[model samples]
Target chain A: MKLGVSLYSFAGDLQTGALTVDDALRYCAALGCEGVELIGEQHIPNWPNTKISDLDHINDLCKELGLEIFCFSYYMNALSHYDRRATMEEHLEMVRLGAATASYLGTRIMRPAFYGVPVENMIEMIKAGLPIAEKYEIIWGVELHAPFPPVYYIDALEKINSPWFRLIPDFSCWQTAGAAGHFQANDVETLRPLLKWTVHCHGKGHVFDEHGEEPNTPYKDLMNILKEYGYEGAVVAESEGWITNYKPTLDVVKTHFKLLEKYGR
Target chain B: MSVELRIPTGGSYALTEQFRELGERVAFPDLNLHKVEMDGMKGYEFKLRNPWYTEFPVSCAEDMEVGINGYAVQKGKIFFVIRDQAVPFKYAKNLYELQWGLGEVAQVRMLDGQLQAVVKEANDVEIKFLLRTAFEGYHLPNNRIEYEFKRNMGVI
Candidate 1:
């Protein structure tokens, strides 16, 4: 499996202006990442309306650094309309934009979080977005994050049985300890059944012990499971330690890369 | 120099403590509020962080109020700036077209001439705003999360 880092991992530094999008990409290269993921809304300037020149600049920079743009992640804030939920057309427009951006970045996979939207609506949105996904040659990975089990979306996945619509299982689902005290661990076994539908994965890391192991996530077991399932997609390291632990983002992400190296094979 | 409280309707104290720790880490030790002249008006500007884990639209900002040396600058006087475009807090509700990128510092400017009195070499600054999480099913009363950043900062 190829190891990668998401620009989202550098969120704290990015928010504080310690690093630019170009600097973050170079940092990932310095960390020996074979691939990298970009969050459109976060990394792309004037997103959903970002200038083609800026997109071309980022694409050229990635090529210069020898880092593969593996995945593009974006959010669908369906409830951002204030008094009402965003209409299906609004969500579809976002999908089109996301797909176009991902296509321009030369990434085949896109992960979207349908925040505040119901499961049924999320399924419909994904279904509606499949044509755009196909047009852009992108695979839409519905992130299987915590507070929701892999099995919970099995029905939805089956409904949208197109090749373009798949899953991006975040390792947070298996977190057993650490800063994620509020999120109960989802049965790791449940993920085994969903591996067939996963096109990308989020190697979510919070606090890591002295041994470069995350006490919160069972990476060894998870790696073994993925290996057993013959999954060979990119495991994008997403450092979230800064969220609650206030740890340095670069340090956490570096350690997370090490953890991925140890078990992400 | 920092104090933060989460008025969660029914969340765990442990989680609240975690968030408090988070607030402390992300909080700027110095208010970093600076004096600037914009549109021929003397004003105060400061960098604001997107406190959420993910990016949110500028429209998500609601009921914003800024305090400088105990003086409160309400919504009408505050503007959230992104990519050099400034939108007033009161009008940001319908401007979901603009987003606050994660780790990207957006400027907050208060142009009300009254702010001139509170601008000093070093002042206590506090900014409190309601952020709409906009998650459909997950309810936080008023569909908003409240955040406050208070610090004793030196003017640059």
Candidate 2:
């Protein structure tokens, strides 16, 4: 499987001006990532209103940096807006925009989430996006989180089961041993069956000790599961520990890289 | 900073009369509002801080202060609660982070071609914090408040 980091791991740092995109790329390469994921909202200047040239510039930069831009994270939710139909229309346009960006970024996979909407509704929304996705050769994948169960999308996947639809399994769904019941981060056993539909992964990392100890998340176990499934895709080091503490956030992110080195195939 | 409380015209969340009846004065505090501005949804990433609140957009550029505490939901009713120091606002960052992005807490949905915000706070304080600066730093007020083109009371 290809290994990488989502620049979002540096969100706090990016917000604080501690990390620059250029340095982040070098940092990812230093950590031995085979590819990388991009968060458009944080990275793009004009963002949703970005010009095509800007997309081309980023794509060219990634090529020169030798970083494979595996996926562009585009989020769409049919339920957030007041008008579901208006929201649907808005997302249909967003799909076209995302596909255009993905085409320029040199990646064929775009990760769009189903936020606060039912599985059927989310699928219906995704169907609206498929025509554009096919046009750009970008595959639309849903990240499996506590809120988004993989099974929920199964019926829809079967109905329009094109190679364009896929899943981005976030390891946070695999809770740490004895973390908290409230987190709703799933266990490996529950997620094992969902692997068949997974195409990419977000190695959501958190809390690492100085002794190279295992953090709350079960990275090793998750890596093994991915291996068992013969999965080959980008594993983005997506961490969130930076929010609370200014210190040790990078340490925790580093731990993810270490764990990946040890267990990731 | 004071926020203009717009009354619900007509819905299950009609909160105009309720907010006008609020006998308590709402206080304000430093808050990080979560607001999600729809720009075709530029991107998605799970922030470890608070996933539930993540969808809501909060701006460092915007001041975290408010004149009123915010809105609350009790037994299926929405109320404007004052942010009193004695009764602090409940920062459910942890709960919001854990409860699957807390989709049930303060949501936006469709009703008769209109977009309405639906919020279900666990407690009065949490709802206040939510409304004042919870997600977008605003709440449901049941008072008839409007500014005319001349910036005055009811006029033609």
lDDT of candidate 1 vs native?
0.76
lDDT of 2 at A83: 18
Task: State which candidate has the highest TM-score.
Answer: 1
**TM-score (all chains, Cα) for each model:** 0.87, 0.62
lDDT of all predictions, in order shown?
0.76, 0.52
Highest-DockQ candidate: 1
DockQ value for model 1 = 0.33
- Residues forming the 10-long window of minimal summed lDDT in candidate 2 chain B: B147-156
Which sections of candidate 2 miss by over 4 Å? A77-85, A147-150, A177-182, B1-156
Q: Positional deviation of A149 in candidate 1, in angstroms? A: 1.6
List each candidate's DockQ score: 0.33, 0.03
